[model samples]
Target: MNTDMTRNDFRTVAREALLAAVQGLVLAIVVLPCGLAFVVLTLVSLAFVPLGIGLLTTPAVLTGVRALADTRRKLAAQWCGIHVPAVYQPLPRGGSPWTRTFVLLRDPQVRRDLLWLPVDMTAGFVTALLPALVVFYPLQGIMLAAGLWRAYVPATGESTWYLFVPVSGQGTAFLAAVLGVAILAVGWRRTPRLLAAHFRLTRAVLGGDAELAERVRVLTETRRDAVDTSAAELRRIERDLHDGAQARLV
Candidate 1:
């Protein structure tokens, strides 16, 4: 029974580790292209400023970025179990494209999103790649153990290996496999926390304090509206009493 439970535990950990690795790979593939596109769009918009086409391009870029940020927030909620609440100020109605763009630009949340982009690109890339590396290292060790290195390096005096660790023969391969298993063991435990940390950072930069402020602002406005509404209702009741009920009594 103990052995069975141990096997099940190992299987569960392995499954989770692989899932995290796949999630990281997906994140990397999506984030890299999106980041590149956003950078390119921003540059194009700037370059087109003198040509006056920037007005069109700039707003489009901002809209795209906002959409992308929203998507990331949702992804964080789904994958990391934490919702980075939206803190974007509502855009004013009945404005020209340029006016609306300026409003978006002025928003603190918008600025935060912009600030998060480069960092996301860098840190996300690393986080996304690391899992796959850990997962695949064992396979590389297996290949080296099987002596397939001879086919690849027919005349090599030396060969460069990943992680700068040698996996030359059965002994080294065994070591490499052990190292890889250790990494896998540690990574499964850490991957969820790592993803959570990234989402927390996203929330911090994109909405943390700003979200609180927005909530406060909303509550204040609601309170004011409620007070005004009560005052108006009291006056209407007094007027009704004076014009109808009191007048009828008189």
Candidate 2:
């Protein structure tokens, strides 16, 4: 029974590690293009400023930026199990385009999202690449151990080491394979944690800090509303009693 439990645990860890590696690769592929588009949109928004076209178009650009940011937030939440909730200020209604644009620009959450663009691109890039790289490096080592390194890089006569010790000759390939196995052993334990750490950083930076405050504000308003409703109900009851029952008693 213990052995069966151990095997199940091992399988679970392996599955999670594989999923994290795939998630990292997907993130790497998607984030780069999204980042580039975000940067381009920002520049275009700026250029439109001089021509006064931004008054008409900047909101759309900003909307795209928000959409991109939202994608990152959603991915982090879904893949990494780190929920980064959004808390955007309500925009004023019935405003001109320019007025709405300025309002969006002035919002704290919008500003934070704008700043998150470059940071997400850079940090998310590293975050997304590291898991895949960590996994790939070990596979490369195994391939080197199989003597395929000779075909890949023909005549580089350098020694490879797991730490500080030298690995040389055909037997050295076996040592490389051993090192690769060791890396896989350790990586299965560490990869998920490392990936979670990266997502935690993302959540902290991109997520709302004012959640508690917002909750408090909402609660306060709700409490007041409830009190007002109760008082209104009591007044209606009193009126009914006075007009019906009290008149009958008199």
Candidate number of the best TM-score: 1
Q: What is the TM-score of each candidate against the true structure?
A: 0.79, 0.77
lDDT tens digits, residues 114-230, model 1? 777787788867766666666766676556657765554436535535355665455665565566566666666666566566667677767657768788889999999999999
Return model 1's CA RMSD, one decimal.
Answer: 4.6
Compose the digit string of candidate 2's lDDT tens values, residues 39-98.
Answer: 888778868876888887888888888888788788777777788877776767888888
Superposed model 1: Cα runs more than 4 Å off:
46-51, 151-154, 167-171, 223-250
State the lDDT at 69 in candidate 1: 86
Clashing pairs for predicted structure model 1, backbone only: none
